[model samples]
Target: MKKNIYSLLKGKFLTSNGASQNWVMIFYLLTLAIVTIGSSHSADQKVHEIAKLNNEVKELRSIMIDGRGQLMKLKKESYLEKKMGEKGIAISEIPPHKIKVKSQKE
Candidate 1:
């Protein structure tokens, strides 16, 4: 067992005649490690992309809300009257009265 340990520590197994299987196993482990690293990197990139999109969505939502608020302010009766007053257009002093007509073809 001491000899085996010493040989293993000295890396003799990699150079021995029966080390083809060990080489294959080493290459397989390396391939798996590389694939795992690539998958992890892909996942991390997707997570970053999702986070960036979320931030963009939040920004757009805030902008939309601000635009809606501005539109509401512009559409208010008081605001319209103020702007129209600046343009020399005054509101009529008389309140509107509805007129009803009776049909003769009853």
Candidate 2:
């Protein structure tokens, strides 16, 4: 066991008769490490992308709320009457009447 440990420590296993299996195992572990590192980086990028999208969503939501508020103000009766008054249009004092028609089926 001591001899085996000493040979392993001295890197003799890489030059021994059974070194082919050791080389394959080393290559496998190296590939696994590379894949793990790549996946970690990919996950980090996705997290950043999600955070950016969330910020954009919040910004869009605020813009939409502001636009809706402005629209509501513009659609108010007082605002419309004021704008019409500027254009020489005035509201008539007479009451409006709705005409009803009877539909005849042939």
Candidate 3:
């Protein structure tokens, strides 16, 4: 009977309003809230930076894609053959291309 009463008393003490379980739960909630706020702040900044880089990549791709046809035309063998024929070593009819640029109007 004494042991039974002592067990009951111990149960009441450990399960009262000031129980260790309640304090531990409160601390866990507080820590979760703090970590959530910290991760949100860092993730928000990273998202903004990723969006900026994506926009920059889009702009550069637009610039690079602008002259696809002209680039293909310049890279053709026909243009190279024509240029080589013009600067042919067989005949000296045409004037040699000079690096110095003289104004056409002057």
Query: What TM-score would every model get versus the actual structure?
Result: 0.82, 0.86, 0.45
Candidate 2: residue pairs that collide? none
> Residue 100 of candidate 3: its Cα lDDT?
88
Winning model by lDDT: 1
- Model 3 misplaced regions, further than 4 Å: 1-22, 67-70, 73-106
Cα lDDT of model 1 by residue, 1-106, tens digit:
9999999999999999999999999999999999999999999999999999999999999999999999999999999999999999989999999999989997
For candidate 2, the lDDT comes to 0.97
Worst 10 residues of 1 by lDDT: 97-106
Residue 17 C-alpha lDDT in model 3: 77
Candidate achieving higher lDDT, 1 or 2:
1
Model 3 weakest lDDT span, ten residues long: 84-93
User: Candidate 2 lDDT, tens digit per residue, 7-70?
Assistant: 8899998998999999999999999999999999999999999999999999999999999999
Model 1 clash tally, residue pairs: 0
Which lDDT tens digits does candidate 3 get at residues 1-106? 9987996677764577778986698789999999999999999999999999999999988888877877988899888777778887343568988698899999
